[model samples]
Target: MSLELYYWDGLQGRGEFVRLALEEARADYVEVVRGKSSEGLGTAAMMALMKSRDEPYPPFAPPFLKDGDLVIAQTANILFYLSPRLNLAPSVESLRYVANGLQLTIADMVTEAHDTHHPLASGLNYEDQKDAAKLRAHDFIDHRIPKFMSYFERVLKQNPAGDTFMVGDALSYVDLSMFQLIDGLLYAFPRALKRFGEHYPRLAALHDAVLVRPNIAAYLESGRRIEHNEACVFRHYPELDKAAT
Candidate 1:
């Protein structure tokens, strides 16, 4: 049976990470909440499932995958589970651990990216948190970006198999996640990313390479690829951008 991915109907959000892996692997799966519904199963449906008693393995949030009798949540954890099955992970135990470590790093960067606009509180509107957002955005541009980029660049440069992929010679889930990270950063912080790109040539190349992958290219061209917006994690507020500059 095909796997069932449950998440908000629109926007990539966290779900896109899992979706990208599935697409890259050419795995058969259905985007559950995105399917036809009278009321439309979006965030509400996702929330209900998380809180439902019927669910033996409730997710902490959206972007959970149900494969047969198993349910898995947490973006990195989902990737951890799917990576081996999809042959998008290293075979060696140490390399697999390294891949997951990189994934966690990506998660940290993503959270920081979201905080750039919602530093005060995610519940508050960007308009309401503009001052805090400015502070956070500046910090991110000045410190966080370089820090994360340096780490990933080191991983690539220090990899035993060379700089082609995150974990050794072959493409892995971490590479795809890194691709998404760079792509989202570029969208959310064009100027900052441009400046940051000069320091991490290999990372930029990986981002470009992932986009050229057949499945990823199709996903990008298709309506499935949601554009970054104010409602999502990586919001582009002019004030935040200006602060970064």
Candidate 2:
């Protein structure tokens, strides 16, 4: 059976991380919300599953995965489960855990990125929270970005296997997520990320490397990949973006 991915339509959001992994592995999966309603794979289908009382493990939000009868929620959780099956994880058990930790950290950074624009409240609009967002975005670009990017940069530089991949000597799901994270940050903060290569050379290299992978390159060029927009986690508001320096 094909794996079912339940995520919101019209935006990359958190789901793009999972999508990146699947695309890299050339995995056969169904994007539930992106499918046609006539095929029982659309927004209504995703809602039905979410609202189903008979479900033993109900998902709290979108970006969940359904494989057979098992349901996995959360971006990191979904990637953790799929990575092994997709051969996008290390063979060593301990290293797999380390990869999971890295993925969760990426998730944390993603949340921080989201909060920059929605610092006051997720329920509030950017226009309404413009004042607080500017402050939050300033801190994000000045402090958080460097802190997180530098850590990942160090991780790559310190990797015993090599500096090319995040875990082990080969590319894993974590690498894919990192690529998406950096790509989103670049899209959302062109000014802030202008000097990314100069500071975080390892991360910059990884991002460029992932962009050229056969499957990844094809997926990116295809219509399947959704463009980042204001509605997603990484929004580019000119007033909220600035150079870290």
Candidate 3:
């Protein structure tokens, strides 16, 4: 059965992380809400499912994946469920748990990235919280980025497989999530990232390497790879971004 991913149409948002794994695995999946009304599976269909009582437990939001009778939500949870099934994690049972741990940390980094621009309230616009955002962004560039990058760089160096992949010796879903996280940071803080890259060479290499993978490279060129914009999690606001160095 084809996997059904319920996420907003034309917006990557948190859904891109799930999409990356699916695309990398070449899994047969449909972006449910990306469809049109003529097909009876569009954004409206996704919203309906969210409120529907058909399922014993409905997701609080989009980006949930429905596979046969099982449905999973939460980015890390969805990836954890899909990783083993899609062959995007290490075959070793223990290594899959390690991959999930890395993914959960990556999710924390992603939340910090989003919070930088909306430190006060998600309901308020960036402009409304510009002061708080500047403070948050500054701290993120100086503290959070270095902290996260250092940990991941250390993971790469310590990996028994080598510094190429996040877990074990292969391209796990964690690596894909790392690539997406770096891509967003670069877009959101190009100058800041350029200044900080020298401290994490292996991490940078992993990000670049993932971009060239056959499936991923094609996805980048395809319409599925939505460009980062103001509406997305990683938004670029010039004043809120700066180089720590």
Candidate 4:
């Protein structure tokens, strides 16, 4: 497995989505940032790759996968590429697009979740825009969460193969991602989640099912699973969360 994954050293951020898929497959890959910098395969290498002009398809940021000569960036895109090869996607070619679309929708929800804390600007610290974040968070928890969570519930109900997974009969990368999304939502807005989780019973069930998977369960308990922090996406602030207040 000559796969090298480049993401931030300390935080899971978007890279964790890709990591979940790889972990589920038990794929041998190098998480560059987690390794020792002295080995010349660290965050610095990832940073250098981002600026490399020699590469044909230059990645704009971290959370990129380097598979032999092919370098792919973006969490959803990388998952779309790897899921099929790793046997983490639907066998049907057409359904692959549906899986990718769901992954992209998850990405949208992630962006909204991230902006809830850094509502004004990603360049600024959450403290700098606390007021805006409060407003953004209120709207996110009150409005956006329901919209997205309900949408996923519908997706699950209409899954054709039943709501066992996000896409097809087996667990795809999209399923792993939705589980991550639900986990993040619970962390960032536990109060809102508790109030609204029941309405999306199917989605909640999917989350529970994914959590118990042997590979996912092991990876989560293992040292590789980075805990949620204020610095990463889905920061939990007491004031920002409706239930906390």
Candidate 5:
């Protein structure tokens, strides 16, 4: 089975969630935008592909996966499609639904995370929207982060399978996504993250475990991992982050 993933060539952004799942499962796939020989056909090329009317199942955004004739979009949707096939989801229908629901919740939290830095406008420069960002960041750090963390902590605690994963005894795509969200928040807001870290030990441990997974470890060390920068969703302006506390 030939699989192709198209997204911005540099930063991980939302695409990294899908990438992490594929990597963790050792799935065979090609990162189209990161192809070395065709340097010019990078992120821009991927965007063009999304907009092309000639392509069937044209994706509305990046991070879409192509496997033969099937095309899937949206990070949660992509994971929902891949999870069962890759053994990254529970077998029972109810368990799978809960896992997908958890993934969707993570997607909402990610959107909120992105908005903390770009509250007013995603296209505008951080400097232009610093004040708005500060307000948003404060709300996220003080309320949203803790609220979401508590909810996830409850899910972990209540799971009949125990504290190992979001859904069942085995790891699921939701687990990887939770790890990504935690890592992003840590990178983008270390000070605020520290304040909330002790409140969610299970979530913290999950993040650590996912990082050490063989494929994830290699991905982090191979220079394929992009540094958090202003261009991406999670920007770290000192003032906004500071104001969060």
Candidate 6:
């Protein structure tokens, strides 16, 4: 059966991470909400499923996955569930947990990235929270970016197998997520990421490697890959970006 991925239409948002894995694995899946409304696979259908009382446990938001009879929510949880099935996870059981931990950490960074533009509140517009966002973005670019990215650099450098992949000897979902994370960061803060190659060489290399992977390259060139926009989690605001020292 084709996996049904439920996420908002237009923007990549948190759903892109899941989409990356699915694309990399060449998994048979359908973007439920992206489908035509005429076919009853649009946002209305997605909302109906969410509101359906027949479901034992409904997701709090979109970016959930429906695999066979199982409904999986939360980006991290969705990736964890799909990774093994997609052959994008480590064969070692213990390393799978490690990959999950890394993915969760990546999620944390993603939240921080979103908060940088909407520091005061998600309810408020970025223009309304511009002042606070500037402050938050400064701290994030100066401290958090280095902290989280440095840890990933260390993870790659210290990988038991090699620096090619995140959790194991081969490509894993964590590596795919890392690529998206770095790519998003670069889009949102090009100035801040200017020194990425110098400071986070391993991570930068990994990002480059993932970019050239045949499946990923094709997906990127295809119209299916949504461009980063203000509505997405990683928004580019010139005033909110600062170059690293």
| TM-scores, all models, native as reference | 0.94, 0.98, 0.96, 0.96, 0.93, 0.98
Residues 1-245 of candidate 4: C-alpha lDDT, one tens digit per residue: 56899999777789999999999999999998878879978878888888887879899987899999899999999998898778998999999999998899999999999999988889998889999999999998778887888799999999899888988898899999999998988888888888555688888888899899999999999999999887778788988998522
- List lDDT for all candidates, in order: 0.85, 0.94, 0.89, 0.88, 0.83, 0.94
Summarize candidate 2's per-residue lDDT along 51-165 as a digit string, tens digits: 9989898999999999999999999999989988899999899998999999999999999999999998899888999999999999999999999999999999999998999
- The 10-residue segment of model 4 with minimum total lDDT is 189-198
Comparison by TM-score, 4 against 6, better one: 6
Screening candidate 3 with a backbone cut-off below 3 angstroms (N, C-alpha, C), the clashing residue pairs are: none
Q: What is the alpha-carbon lDDT for the whole of candidate 2?
A: 0.94
Candidate 4's C-alpha runs over 4 A off are none
Which digits, one per residue and each the tens of the lDDT, describe model 1 over residues 56-168? Answer: 87888878988898889899999998899998989887888888988998999999998998888878888898888898898999888888899899989998899989998
The superposed Cα distance between candidate 4 and the true structure at residue 29, in angstroms, equals 0.6
**Model 6 over residues 59-166: C-alpha lDDT tens digits?**
989899998888999999999888888999899999989999999999999999999999888998889989999999999999999999999999999999999899
lDDT of 5 by residue, 1-245 (tens): 65888788668799889988888888888888877646644666777778887988788888898878788888899889888888898988888889888999999999998998888887888779888888889889888988999999889988899997888898888999899988888888888887555788888888888989998898878776787776666767777665233
The per-residue C-alpha lDDT of model 3 at residue 194 equals 79
Error of 1 at 64 (Å): 0.7
The residue-by-residue lDDT of candidate 3 on 29-136, one tens digit each, is 988887887998888888887898787798998789998978788999999888888899789999988988999899999999999999999999988999999999
Root-mean-square deviation of each candidate, in angstroms?
A: 1.9, 0.8, 1.2, 1.5, 2.0, 0.9
* Model with the higher lDDT, candidate 1 or 6: 6
lDDT of 3: 0.89
